[model samples]
Target chain A: EAGVVQSPRYKIIEKKQPVAFWCNPISGHNTLYWYLQNLGQGPELLIRYENEEAVDDSQLPKDRFSAERLKGVDSTLKIQPAELGDSAVYLCASSPRASGGASDTQYFGPGTRLTVL
Target chain B: AQSVAQPEDQVNVAEGNPLTVKCTYSVSGNPYLFWYVQYPNRGLQFLLKYITGDNLVKGSYGFEAEFNKSQTSFHLKKPSALVSDSALYFCAVSPVYGNNRLAFGKGNQVVVIP
Candidate 1:
């Protein structure tokens, strides 16, 4: 089976511009996650989705960052009026489920490298 | 609050020698620990995990980790290092059956030299 897939491996935008990244999880996976990874740091959870519902988004910057998981298969993460601090890798991952004795190994995508000028 | 720590930023090992990468975690409940490896410009690949049973868990590409509840550590090890094993390694943990949110360490880069 194919692993997680992401589009536009790199993105460059101005500080006040908008940028978006896309992700497609593995087939039959029921959970998807969006994470931000600053250089030299680990990935941090931004949002998580179980099917089409976003179960957790506490860490997401609602002021400018928004995400959507339409059809429960593919997802899009958008950042409007990007800040220089927003320059980091945006990683997408998926798993089978998040409950009851299930394996919780997440499959990650190559990630989109976003640079804000 | 769940958190993970990797003390070393990089680990160097000669090829054919044993290697180890250290990781420690703190969580409220029982821990679900995982190890992942990432090659250059690639996504992270699952290596191993420790859920409940045995402390020693074996994983992909000769990698294994020992879960120590007392020390709160889950260090990854390999019996014999290979040049291809050089990559960035991450240790992550989530509280048992808790919110599926994972706390990850900063990651450790392993270099295997010939």
Candidate 2:
């Protein structure tokens, strides 16, 4: 089976501009996640969706960042008026099992690297 | 809330030698620990996980991790190092009952000298 897929592997934008990243999860996966990875740091969970419902989004910056999973298969993460600090890698991951399971192993995509100048 | 810590910034090992990357985590109840490897310009790949059974869990690419409840640690180990194993490794943790939010460590860069 194909792994998770992401679009626009690299994106460059000036500060205050809007940027969006898209993700397509593996077939039949039920859970999807969006994470932000800063330089030299591990990924931080921004949002998580179980089917079409966003089960976890406490860490997402609601002021500027928003995400949507229209059909529960593909997701889009958008950052409006992005700041310099928003420059990082945006990663999307999916798991086959339900949420809260210890056996759910998340498969990641080749993240979209955003550079805000 | 749960969190993870990778104590080392980088680990260097010669080929054919044993390799180790240290990781520690903090959680309220029973913890679900995981290890992932990331190559250059690639996504993170699942290596292994420790749930409730044996402390020693084997994973892909000849990687294994030992879960120590007493110390709250899960360290990745490889019996024999290979040049292709050079990459960044991340340790993650999540509570068994919460929203299944994973907390990841800063990641450790491993360099295997050929």
Candidate 3:
């Protein structure tokens, strides 16, 4: 089965420019997540979508970051006026729906590496 | 709040030698623990998980983790290290009642010298 797919394996932009990252989760997976990873740091959850509704986004930086998952299939994460601090890898992951109170392991994408100057 | 800790930033071992990476977690209730590995220029891959049952959970690439409930630690171990096994390892955890949100440690880079 195909794992989560992310576009533009890499991106380089100047500070203040806008950037966007796209992700397509594995088929039949009902949960999607976006995470940000800095150097030597583990991926941190930015947003989570159960279908088209974002159920968890408390960790997302609302000042310049926004995310949307339309039709509950593909997702997009955007950062306007990107800052150097925004440079990091944007990862997308997915998992099957939880059943009977059991947790499912997540499958991750190759991730989009973004660099801001 | 839940958290994970990888005390060592890196672990070095000779090929064919045994290796271990330490991880400790803090959470309420029965915690769900996991280990993930990341290769250069690639995304993290699930190594293994401990939900219930056996304290020793085996995972991909001949890696295994021992869950010590009393110590609040889940340490990843391998009987024989391989040069190909060199990568970044992360320990993640979620509370039993959490909405499946994972808290991860910074990560431990494993170096298997050939």
Candidate 4:
């Protein structure tokens, strides 16, 4: 089985520009997550989706960041008016189950590295 | 709020020697601990997890972690290090009863010398 897939492995944009990242989860996976990883830091949860419903998005920056999983299989994260501080890696992960049990090991995709100048 | 701590920034070990990476976590209730490895320009790969059963949990790539409730620590270990084992290792935690949000620690870079 193929692992989670993400598009545009590297992106460069100027400040105040808009940027978007896309993700495709593994087959039959019911849960998807978006995380942000700053340099020398671990990945932090930005949003989580169970099927088409976003179950957890409390950490997402609503003022500039937005995400959607319309079909529940693929997801897109958009950042409008990107700032210099927004430069980092955006990762997408998926799991087979939604119960969040120990068996639900999340598989991650090669993240998209965004550089905002 | 759950948090994880990986004390060391980097660990160097010779091939055929034992490898260890330290991690500690803080959570409200029972914790679900996990370990992951990331290679250069690659995604994080699942190693293993500890939920309820055993204190020692074995994971992929010949790695294992010991979950200590008393110390609130889950440290990853490998019996014999290999050159290919050089990578960034991360420790994560989530509360068993709360939302399944994973809190990750700053990753530890493991360098295996040949």
Q: Judged by lDDT, which candidate is best?
A: 4
lDDT of 1: 0.92
Over B3-101, each residue of candidate 2 has an lDDT whose tens digit, in order, gives 999999999999999999999999989899999999989999999999889999999988999999999999999999999999999999998877688
lDDT of 1 by residue, A36-92 (tens): 999998999999998998989999999999999989999999999899999999999
Residue B8 alpha-carbon offset, candidate 3, angstroms: 0.6
Ranking by lDDT: 4, 2, 3, 1
Clashes of each: 0, 0, 0, 0
Which tens-of-lDDT digit does each residue in A1-117 have in candidate 2? 999999999999999999999999999998999999998999999999999899889999999999999898999999998999998999999998766655589999999999999
lDDT of each: 0.92, 0.93, 0.93, 0.94
Predicted complex 1: CAPRI docking category: medium
Q: Give the best candidate by DockQ.
A: 2
Error of 4 at B40 (Å): 0.9
Candidate 2 regions with alpha-carbon error over 4 angstroms: none
In candidate 4, list every pair of residues with a backbone clash.
none
lDDT of 4 by residue, B6-97 (tens): 99999999999999999999999999999999998888999999988989999898999999999999999999999999999999999988
Q: What are the per-residue Cα lDDT tens digits for candidate 4 across A1-117? A: 899999999999999999999999999999999999999999999999999999999999999999999998999999998999999999999998876543478899999999999
Chain A TM-score per model, please list them: 0.95, 0.97, 0.95, 0.96
Looking at model 3 chain B, which ten-residue stretch has the lowest summed lDDT?
B94-103
Report DockQ per prediction, comma-separated.
0.67, 0.78, 0.66, 0.71
Clashing pairs in 3: none
Q: Score residue B82 of candidate 1 by CA lDDT.
A: 99
